[model samples]
Target: MSEVLVVRGEMQPWTDHTARQPVLAALLADVIPANRRTLILGPHSPLLIESVLAHSADVTILVRSVSDAEQLTETFGPCLHVVAGALDGLKRAAAVQPTLFEVATDGVQPFEVVVAADGLDRVLGYDSEHLSWTERLAAVRSLATPDAVVVLGLRNEFSMLNLLDRRPAHLRHGDDEWVPLHDDPTRPVSVDQFQAALPWPAQLYADFSAHTLVGVEAAATARPGHLPTRLAVAALESVDTPLLTSTTEPLESAARAGLLPAVPTSWLAVCNAPTPHTLYTHSGPTTLKATATETGWETTVGVVTPDLLGTVGYDSTVVPARVPGGESVETVLFRLAAAEDVPGFRKLAAALGEWAEDSRVLLRWDDVIVAGDTFAFGISGWVAPESVDKDDLLAAAWLRFHRRLVDGHRRHPWPPWMIGDELVSTWLSMSGVTLVDPTPATAPHVESAYAEQLAWGKQLAAALSVVLDSPEQTHPDLRTQLADADRARLELTELQGHVFGLERTLGFRNKAMKTRENRIRELRGQLQKATTANNKIHSSRCYALARRLAQFRNPRKVAAKARRILRQNLNKLRPAS
Candidate 1:
């Protein structure tokens, strides 16, 4: 008796960002037909699986656990044959015809399409320790029939985001249980390395952001963003100033190899393995080359390769929504000029949009604000032209601020707001010296006021510029006061140093006095003791006899000299008359 596959009915809703159902649905819908027998290695994108089910696609799902298989069967119904087993088990089952318990072995001899959308990381583990990427690839290969199309998704180890953001987005986990413990390869393989590892011929596309995939031969490229590839590349390279070897090597390799894209956050590879499934028919070259024309930019946006250009031609109707911003006028002009040359006006338009935005919100609101002086005014629809003279605009804004101060003094008695460079840039978009516009309206009076403001603003801005450029003459008294303050500070510092020195000297003196007092007390005690001893000797008859004998024994001249010396010391101690 053979054991039957048991499917568990309980499973949680898929929550991983990597499980991008919408994108997978769109991609799979284009490639897989309604009636093809499909084998899904992992139920990562349930939406994709459900979408294909509507097309009456014969599908077999292979899952890691019985619970996953049961949950999939419960959701998808009996139409989905959920097999709870490893890749090896599935391969063995594929060789046999349907038995009493065999599910997917019925009509279809082998699966025409095999998809491991969860990627090799799921199978081999990201750390590359559980199984080699090559081994995982072979396992995916074995699941399919001789002519099966395999769709895979892979992670780019050397992406632009990984280089710029220290903690890259990939590091984040979908859930606590799904934390990616697998470390990236110590030496990440490049496109060439990846290509070399491929079991078959493939075409790779530069897919931006996440959700990139690897497909079998003749795969279509993903949609490009508002920024064109050429422009995007230039922008990234120009700003990659701190490009370390880790970053530079990948970029240089992509450029030098020519087959790989220079600026995508991710990539997709389409392998060439002949399959019964027909690939989606697409137009345009796989590559593009942007060139400047007299009126606008001429960009060839189609399938372009290093050596070959595909049938698709450049589309002329595209335009950039905004222009890119830069620190300097030269940079802005350069980007603007580049945008003009590109076929789509999208880049130039994006930059223009950004410039207009800057003209409105350049000022940091709180910086120039005086808490109680002026009411806050919001500006909208502020647009800047290509040739903006920032200095002229700033000066005009400053002059208007000054005018408001004067007008307020006579009418409202409110102080004028302090103008800063940012504020000047912001208000310069308005008509000359206009303080505020309470309503959003286009009146004839407003237009006239605006023109007058511009004329007056130009003059005021020029005058303000002159005032700021020239150094103001200092008052003689102010200079003298500053000098006096400096001298006072020096004297104070010196006095502090002296005070510290005196404190130290006093401490030493106090210590010496204490020592001297102790010494004097000790001498007094010794004198008292001597007096007692002498009294005792004088009272005793033996002492008097011995003293007389000594006096007689001593020379008379020595005694006389001693008496004179003692009298001299006694006289010296007497008070002066």
Candidate 2:
């Protein structure tokens, strides 16, 4: 059973809601003193507490929430002592009631190890007296023995993540931030300030996230494909927080200006510990810790299992911890491409081709580290399921690299129009692999690796299309211009379809008007012919006589004239008969 101490008059309505960070916990575990009395301040991940317990049997955890303290006691059992109280209340209780404070501390003695990795923000209770950043640090230090090991973490207000965050400060504020002291002037914002604030010498680490930590010197001197640069870039790229813009460009600019270490998301300071030169990161399920040595890099994996390879359909292979003595091929290739050195690229391709032909190992540009003329796999943990052809493997590797280049918006020396399989084929031909055509449809029959690579590329492309299409300005590379041209062409096609529909409608209307005009012309012609015939009939002599006889003044005169005409006609008819 664990010991639980609850301070009277402690804050009752406050609860800490901070999240657990595994990477930070791992780092803390590396520096925590072994077999010494340790005190953990504020809320922390259960993983960290477990690690601390493993190192030291006697551990004390102080939290403002009574519920949190009870939960810690339940989880840790007798190995942990939980104190539910604010800092001020603990201080007063120690002075007024020595027995109660002794129960919380296990004795009236100072701690040999003090860990405030969660920072000082969450230590104060709502009803307790407020303390500034420096005051909080002093309070934590006062509880530790004269030669105690102290591990501290501080959040940087001007970090790139905070600067790029789109949410307003008030909107991002949490319920526990009733008396937020993030803006305290005494708070350290840089490595120098943090070191200066501490009484003992401290080693600083630039904490990009829970999964990545780079030494201050390593980050300051990072370059294109150096391990530190790789880790930093990977960390920034994997961030899930919604930001006002992509951090890719900003990170590159920072690296170029040698300001990367100065603007990390957070800083970790370790006192009474050896200077740490190792870089630690968690890539997916694999935890990679690399340290630079005289010969080369000495890398170690925390967990070595088949699960590290994800879904590549390959058997488990244990990779060596030591890296080859050379620079990564990716770094050299990026340099060549950026300079637009076509001849140099071709020469390197030929050399890589020869190496691949000789050594039947799979070659990924980033995985292949080169020293002089020697090429070898750097840090990888998977093998092909079966024997794959050299041509297929080379083609797959180049095609994947091409996809990365396009996705990253990287520049190359190839023609602006040369893209997709065509450009890939060109590179392969230079590498002594002959492929007349390499389209997705024919990829399966020609090379199974090619088809598989294409499928993976399509899926990744869909996922990254949004980021690639962001409105941020980048180098106007061929891929970017091609994407823009494709959009323009699509718009043009729609406009042409709309114009064609309008033309068809106008043509139909013109045809209908022509038909109506022809009908009207024919009707007019018939009416003109009838009028001519009527005129001719009126001009005839018989018609004129009938008209004159009918116009007589009286009906009697008309009848007498009709009888005389009838008698004349009857006499003439009789003679004719």
Candidate 3:
């Protein structure tokens, strides 16, 4: 019994598809008044529409494609209304032209909650009159009741994704982008402008996909273990966009300067609703939900199924959640390091060392919350798989933090030249831990994870380390450097193989030379013995007369006479036979 109303002149052979943003849908669900009329403008994920239906049975979705409307109607039979029309034709007073049909909204009631999270880009049809961004906003506004809770999604043209995108303008869009109103003068480009455009007070959020939605203020002043900081890190680390360079350093700088909200991929404006500062991130297959509280963050898994930690190389026993009432140790340590407070940093390190000595699980600074002398774990469900030595655990934790610090371009008290194992050893010494080599054989999984993290960190660091003379110059330079390094490594490997072959050839040649030298020495010794024997025979008395006769001028004649005598002796012997 679902209603599918079609306004003639709707766009044909066109279906607008939007990405499914679960966290945004969850936020919208939280704000949508239960049992009230709701309006969803533009194409949204079916999952999101279902979430909307869960709160309110009376809902209407507007899309420009008749096929899309029919599909939605079939999917949600009797639960909601699907309207197929352009925004211009949705008004009750729309002109009924001969060429185009108008939608009749006479019986439709004003919506109590309005959601246009997909934004205003796809709300118009090809046959409809062109409308400016402001005009579209007005059209959407005209559908809602006064004081209605409205959630609007606005795309940031100056977002890091857009700025770093290397795609040509023509290639960046699809066929559906034929009538993009990017140059509309009335469009709100920033959070401030977006808020000003709304008639009601609105809370602005940086929507970084389904995993992260950070409040403007929270993002500006994010600290370690804070929901905004954690979620922002997770989102940045998980970016799949092919950008010319990493946005990690730029975003961190923006956050420090309180300009992070101005540069997100998109913004969400929620009016007349309470918004929780939260993070929805995944660890392996488990979804983690972290919400900010007055004391600290409370984190729990979103879906409670059978334990999957062991499959993901995590401890089977889930760590119990506790509301740790304190600032995170990471924040304090970072503050101390940035301020160059060596004594304070060392003292805290020593204290952390003392506490870690008896701890059963690995202690990451960000996971440890500190209130005066008391310390508690802030994150839950991250435990060591097996018992680990105190020193080894400390080394792993500090070394991982070291990589992050260097990779994130964070300032520290240590000298700039001190890096890698030297800095880690120095930090460990301050923590009263000896610098023993914790071989990978001792903890293979942890070591492998750390190695992977280190590699990623190094790559990120290299990508972000270019001089800021100009982005145009620096990005290519970094790429060139990476390519050159790879080429050099290949050349080195080839050279090593060549050198090995040459060494084998040289060894064979040396052996051959040694054998030839030994044969020459043996030949000389045999010739000298033969010469000594010939001299002894000549010195004999009976051979002296024969030697004198052989030395006569007729030596050839003597040889002929000897031959004749031998022939005669042979003839006499034959006759006797």
Candidate 4:
């Protein structure tokens, strides 16, 4: 059996067991049409193949090792077009040297779709001399049709994950030069930068750690408004993302519209040339419908109208009102506004501006405007613009996203204990961030420390037991004190059980009292109704007589009827005599 190729201390032939695969596949299924010829670089995942096959597309998998190719051929049979060779060699033959492709079994034909499922990382590590990001991307493009869709799975560097995981080290294989890999381009390019990098226009979908590709112009201004609620909540709760609140803008218009700021670790990029299509994006052609006011600009998004800048609850009761966008970008500058952290807001805005366009930073008084309270300060909302997959890819992506949330929560537990921090507590409420795990850190040292403490505790308890039991080590008074303590502990345990029983009995009695009280109230109501009827009867003389008659009529008629019957019987008896 051929051993799997290892890179950077990880197996290259297989994909990580992540939820991203299904999500990416689902996204791909949505974008790529069935019956299209697809070129898959790096069969890093069986899920990638399954996603491609789901659409019944013409599939081709290119692997670097001969053993991998042979194994794939056996596993998938003749249906799979498995090719073995280095990407650099293929690039040299097809592009650099103008030679025929070794894997061109049925002759080279332009592929309608090309997927870098293994991502640039694996592709970069395929040979001794890794390919540059631009060259690798260009080489992948060469296998595509004129207007074929190009999908790239990218990692986001700005994610909260990077802050915790600092494990990147690049070194030359032969030379001892310790430098970052050529493939290690500053990741997570903006939508504009990403488009500029590509020969064709493209859109980006990013989370905290990952992104996906889609065609340009596919990103609608309103796309962020319609994400899944769970997905939206994840984004909103993300402390790493500044404009996660932008998702709530669409919620005002429609409840079913999806939520945002997914913080997913993987990204998907779609390049459209042959067929232009729409894809979801965070930032798109957002038109700021704002009207200039005496103090500042009044903004409107979705159904929320006349959003007065630097004001709290000015339009609290107001419905949709008219507002117009000025030619200039809206920037609500604040100076000495009550309770407004102008400096902090500016700092945060500067940080966020790195990822967004037309970066207008504003400070508004946050917190509810109480009847008497005069001051409030915080961030209310922020907007961001930006820009998935086949079915198996989508399923994998969904699974990955879910796992990320679950595992992420497991990693960095929510701060329920940090309720004292108003900002953090409030952010938790507004954002969809929830408690995944309550345990502390999950790192090796953290776990090891816990284990050590537990062992120490057990040892301490055993030592205490031994010391207490050993007559040689213990004083007579100490032994007597220990016996007394044991007796007290037993007494306390018995008292606790007795108290528990009493508490249950008290609860039952309380319920019975409540039941009696309700019954008494019902009877009182009935008595009140009867008294009212009696008063009504007494108020009218005729009604009183009719009511009395109703009460006595039946007895009086029965007595009168019995006397008449007796008289008739006496008359008949006399005649018979």
lDDT of 4 by residue, 106-202 (tens): 5454577887745555443334455566766766776666677787765444333332222332311222112233345643344445556777555
Candidate 3, 1-577: lDDT as tens digits: 6667776447777777767667776677678888887888888989789889999847878898888888888888878777788888776323533212223356343677889888888888888887888888887777776688898888888886677766677766676655777689999888888888987788888876555777776566664445465456556545565556566656656666777777787888888887654554443335555566666666665544433333113332354354454566877887888898999989998888887764445556765778669677654444444555676666766766786677555788788657776676677778886554445555543433234323422432232222101123323324335666897999999999999999999999999999999999999999999999999998998799887786788778889999999999988889553
Report the alpha-carbon TM-score of model 2 versus the true structure. 0.73
Report the CA-based lDDT of candidate 3 relative to the real structure: 0.69
TM-score of each: 0.40, 0.73, 0.68, 0.37
Superposition error at 97 for model 2 (Å): 8.1
Which has the higher lDDT value, candidate number 1 or candidate number 2? 2
Q: Name the candidate that leads on lDDT.
A: 2
lDDT of 1 by residue, 122-176 (tens): 4321222344466667767655555566666555655564454333355533442
lDDT of 1 at 251: 41
Global lDDT of each candidate: 0.43, 0.71, 0.69, 0.42
Ranked candidates, highest lDDT first? 2, 3, 1, 4
Model 4 RMSD in angstroms? 25.3
